[model samples]
Target: MTVTVDEKRCIACGMCAYAAPEVFRIVGSASTVVAQPEGKSPRVRDAANGCPVNAIRVEG
Candidate 1:
């Protein structure tokens, strides 16, 4: 449920926050990981996949 967004690649698109509000948020110019995604939830993967810049990464 670990979610991380690369600062260098994030574009603040807000899709991560929109798709996985529990785990992600847009802060200023970057997408920030707010909390870990729930176990086996599709939201996190969806958010990661939705990132046009491929900035979001999920582990475990």
Candidate 2:
């Protein structure tokens, strides 16, 4: 799976990184995913869903 962050919608709240530090980070006022969500780990998906602005997108 792949995780993409919508910079436009990102508020730099750092929720994604907080939820899944392995998969996400706050960089230059934006949220970025450093790892791929290939396994069954729900961290990435959870972060996406937890985003208040819906800035994260996950694709398998």
Candidate 3:
């Protein structure tokens, strides 16, 4: 699985980073995930769902 972040929809809440620091980080004022490491999709997706603004996406 792969994850994608809709930067435009982000609210800088930092929930994703808090939920999964290894997969997500605060870049400037938004959250982002390193989606190319092969086995982090579930963590990223969980982070996304944990976001209050719903700013993340997961794709297989």
lDDT of each: 0.86, 0.87, 0.74
List the candidates ranked by TM-score, beginning with the highest.
1, 2, 3
lDDT of 2 by residue, 1-60 (tens): 788998988999998898889888899989887878667668888888899999899887
- Give candidate 1 regions above 4 Å deviation: none
lDDT of 1 at 2: 80
> What are the per-residue Cα lDDT tens digits for candidate 3 across 1-60?
677678898887888877777777789877777544476556677786787877887767
lDDT tens readout by residue for model 1, 1-60: 687899999999898899988888888899888777668778889988889999988888
Question: Could you give me the TM-score of model 1 versus the true structure?
Answer: 0.91
How does model 3 score by TM-score?
A: 0.75
TM-score, every prediction: 0.91, 0.89, 0.75
The top-ranked prediction according to TM-score is 1
Q: What is the lDDT of candidate 2?
A: 0.87
Instruction: After the best TM-score superposition of candidate 3, give how far the Cα of residue 12 lies from its true spot, in angstroms.
Output: 1.4
